[model samples]
Target: MKRYTKLGLILTIIVTCFYVTTASAQGHYNVLKYGAKNDSSKLATESIKKAIAAASKAGGGTVYFPAGKYLTGPIHLKSNITIYIEAGAEIHFSDNFDHYLPMVKSRWEGTDVMNFSPLFYAINAENIAIKGRGLIDGHGKKWWAYSEVHVKKIPTSRWQEEFKRLNKDVLAPDLPGWIERGFLRPPFIQTMDCKNVLIEGITITNSPFWTINPQYCDNVTISKVTINNPDSPNSDGINPESCRNVHISDCHISTGDDCITIKSGKDRSGRKANVPAENYTITNCTMLSGHGGVVIGSEMSAGVRRVTISNCVFDGTDRGLRIKSARGRGGVVEDIRVNNVIMRNIRDQAIVLDLQYATTTVEPVSERTPAFRNIHFSNITAHGNRAGYLNGLEEMPIENVSFNNMNMDMQTGFRIKNSKDIEFHNVRVNNKKGPVVEAENVVGLQIDDVRSQKPVAGEAIIELTNVEGAIIQNAFPAKGTEVYLKAKGAKTSDIVGKANHFGNVKTVVIQEADVKEKIKLD
Candidate 1:
């Protein structure tokens, strides 16, 4: 009798504990409790969607996923909900094309289209988040095999027929592009026109396209995210297009394309959208093995302004701090600043600001021309094949740029062409060959306290061609210099020297007799 009484008391206590726990977790909906299987045998997409629906119906709650492997389709997020994946959970998206049916409105490569739904998608959502330490695996091997032609092992009838099922007539302007470029891959996560967004503490890998893309979002924050998608084509990491007031920090990215690309859009579509990516701050990030680190568009059509990037490290990237736009891309990129950055093993130029990225025929300055101004770089150190390259269009020259406290070790030196109001201060280049500074078709150029560490013989320390209004002040040329300054262009005029100490140079200010009157010494 006593033993039976004790067993009843213990059962009652256990029931009380469970009831208390259930009552406390009132607004939390777990996927496992909603018939979600952990094993990979079955599709857990329906059950997970059910959980999301339940959470939404309950006046906005948390949809939780515990530690397990779950296969699923696209996850469509609603407002005022957080999809929290526990530490060891894995959400593996299936690669079957049919799973991504009923095409959604999205932007691809800076153009609007009705394309495949992104893996995690939200449109016009407010106060949404996807947080916690988990894995989002986009199994894109088969998709890649299909996207790349000439190695097409599968029939085009599958994806082609799926696209044909949609009414292209309704999707105007998006029709011919969509019809021509059939079945483009989707991004890993995309939020369109969202506000008060947050994405934190997630490790994303194997994305099909641009990973972590947010379009036209305001007050967005992405922190502590790890993105690893190497050798995958067009897989840019953290591309925020036409977004404002964005904060991106503490990210470790290694991708096949540019790591952290900022864009307003491309060509006509971008101009029509008319939204500029502005008020952005990016810091405390490390990038590895990308085409470029912190690149701002070859596709900026609307504009880009008020961007700040600091305290970043670029290791083994092709280029660092690249800003490229072409003639047809009509935009104004300005008020940009970059400081306290380190770059190593750069294959190309460390700094690139080219206005002729696509090389169009010279046309009159109109709405199709792009402009770059008011950009500054400071406290930068790099080692690369070339230190810097700045190429502006002849019609619209890049203007009002400055570089201060720069230290670079390069095989080649800096090259500038068709620019205006350029300034360099306290710059040192340890070049193995060539002049430290070379200019062509430049105006209002200023160089102060600039020197080459390892100056080679028979090469001028500074070479100028077609330059006007040039000022050289406090320039200390290095040893083994043949000529300190060479001015040869017929159009060059108003070359002024102020307190320039050419102590180690063999000759100072070697101007051709035809243009000798243009060179001035003070």
Candidate 2:
């Protein structure tokens, strides 16, 4: 009798432990349990918040929403939690402007300010994720309509009045005057100062502003996501600002603005933060109908470096592989490498490096001077492009840019200005205009095995002005070309050529009256 009693006690203990382990493993806090009604008419804001709080208090677990439509406002995420919307579930953000009240710390167009909170926000959290094959609708029509009425193209008189009001309300606002007084919209999903974040397998639509924006975060992975916002203004697909160690892969983005823009900050505010968006790897992404395929910034004031983009396809984009910044935005963008990129139906330049992006006047060389260097492009093929423009600033010229194995079919060929240490190897452009290659104010230029096809007027195939230390070797111009090389400038010297075939003509024109020394040709 004593032995049987001891065996029974052991069995009871084993059964109790099994139940505990099972409960721990399946710790899913359903929103329905927290008074969240699945009816589309009801607002599930408080219930969802309760669910998140309960799960967080219980050492973190999944906040699950079953197959139904849950309408809410501004879902805030916490640490050590995962919000999983099951298949056929949808989270629709309400259009109530008052619901996003009590502004939070956020960035609007690269400037830090206290604004309306993002649709989904998180701060100072770790190991947070929003995953599942569901849908997130931002209900952005109201925001878009509001911006059109108040923000876009305000009258000059109204602008002055608004500026006065902004200065009076907020002391020294950094953003534009039009966007100062509650005109700037919030992003769809924003996480600041968070770590170990994962956003995967979700279809997002109609964002109020930028779709996925992560600022000052680390170890972020965004994969298998689809963003479809075709007509909303400023609806950028994914923008990573002041973040590090990010990976964006296998995303299909078709937005109204830039597909993917990497930035740090904008102006003085950006320089004060002193954090750069670096160490990013973007691969196997499809960009469609955006401003640019993969843009660096018009707002990168806090130096961006060490980014690699490969195996991407850009169709019907305005520009491909663009980097733009103005004078007052002081940053150094370097070590950017792109390979195996194919572009079609490009509306503007296939590749652009414009240091004079927005501002027209030149400023003194200081910490605010923008610089681009050490950028390399290889194995790129572009068709139906207008031109390839590489215009740098006179004060701070673009340096150390290389292009290899490029085949372009465009209306005009390359127009390089105010650059140094440029090289083009095995490059071909079937341009439709004369003067296929034009270079001005260049230093240390080299063109190897470069060819152009069928000039219309037999004009000079390559035109050089104010260039120094130029080497042209193994260049084959088209037949009926008037001049193989036309060199003219006071500073043009050391122009050398070897093994070049000047088809049907061998005329080299050098205006050497004001040249410092005679040009050397071999």
Candidate 3:
């Protein structure tokens, strides 16, 4: 009888503990009563900090930000914690830049500096999440206006001239003191060297610079988040730099700069750092008022590789898909695959692959060089105002570029310069029919099933200048529209194509015969 009573007591205790643990893990850790000695509306920054501290002391819990304008300065996020701002809650940032001053380690323009601290930041924290349908307003218009004025005053040529006179032996611009003057402000959520982070369903707006920038993080997923920041200058949506295994999806971004940018590092400072931003997947996103719908690097000296972007839409953006880098940036961006893209009302080219960025002047190029290669764009539909351009630097003509099943309605056809080993399969570009295809300084070109609405004034569907081993195979007229191949000094003997094979690149017009094998449909 005594033994049975002891067993019953033990089971009762076990059941009670299980219930307590489960209940503790699933509810809100309200900050109303966490040592707020006075009122909640008063200076409760210390009280909220204490509440978070108490939660951390008890092995991590959700720090709930209730409904109100909770004004606070920088809040440091701890590990094993999730900050859930309720549906009506808003955590407003303190406006004074001096409040976020006294510099922390952060990255701006691919270089690490000790400047303005981020509003909500963490370093090396695991299992962290910022999830809820709440607002994180940066209140950064005052700072953004100041920084833009600072950048505009300092021109590159003027800086170059000043550096030449000041320090004759210096190669790069010596701007340590200039940078120290607090010109470049940091982002809102600048988490450095963190792991296992997820930011979902939150609306982050009004950033001083780029909205959400996670530098040197791994295993991060940012989905269903709406980033709305338009007033501020250089307000990029999400910039994941030098990170790995990232997935960003279902986000609507409207900003002043590039909507989503993938970068590694920049210039001599970035190349010396040696961290590559790789292994990212972006899908189901919409962008507005940005430089590119999806962009990779004007500042990637450490390289970007193995990126896949699909099922995205760009409306009223500057360019649909842009890959930009400069001569001094010695990096390789390869293995990029883009599919199922719908672009409309784009101001510039539907797709641009340019090596010389931010320059109109022509300079010498070299072969021991940085270039873009192995890029595949398939199943894309675009309505563009101008012609798409594929410009590779003189030394590094973009290699192994393939375009399959693309349908474009533009004012002009596609133009290529200084690129080699290019292929266009089933590409139909409808325009006023001046020059359907133009290629300069290319090698080993191929065009199959390429058709246009009007007759190209130039007799060449393939116009090549300084090109070698160019081939135009299986191209024919469609709907009374003419097809021609023009190459200046490029041999027609090297080209091969059936005349009936020319039509629309999006759909096949020519049926396969004995000599021409049907490219297996995928």
Best by TM-score: 1
| Per-residue lDDT over 61-148 for candidate 3, one digit per residue giving the tens place of the 0 to 100 score | 7888777667777777777778887777777777776676556777777866555678878888877788889898888887675564
For all the candidates, what are their Cα RMSDs to the real structure?
4.8, 5.5, 7.6
Per-residue lDDT tens digits for candidate 1, residues 1-522, read 999999999999999999878745657878889888777667888898898899888777778888989899999988888898889998899998678767788887777777788999999998889999999899876666655442433456766656655536432332133345466788999999999889999999999888999998998899999999988877899999999999999999999889999999877788889999999999999999899999999778889999999999999999999999987789899999999999999999899999988747898998778899999999999998999999999999999999999999998888999999999999999888888889999999998888887886778878898898889999877777778788887888888899987778778878876574656555
Tell me which residue pairs clash in candidate 1.
none
Misplaced by over 4 Å in model 3 are 1-23, 26-28, 35-45, 149-151, 154-182, 360-368, 454-460, 480-483, 489-493, 499-522
Q: Candidate 1 — what's its lDDT?
A: 0.87
Give TM-scores for every candidate, taking all chains together and pairing residue i with residue i: 0.91, 0.89, 0.83
Give the count of colliding residue pairs in each prediction: 0, 0, 11
lDDT of all predictions: 0.87, 0.84, 0.74
Score candidate 2 by lDDT: 0.84
lDDT of 1 at 83: 90
Better by lDDT, candidate 3 or 1: 1
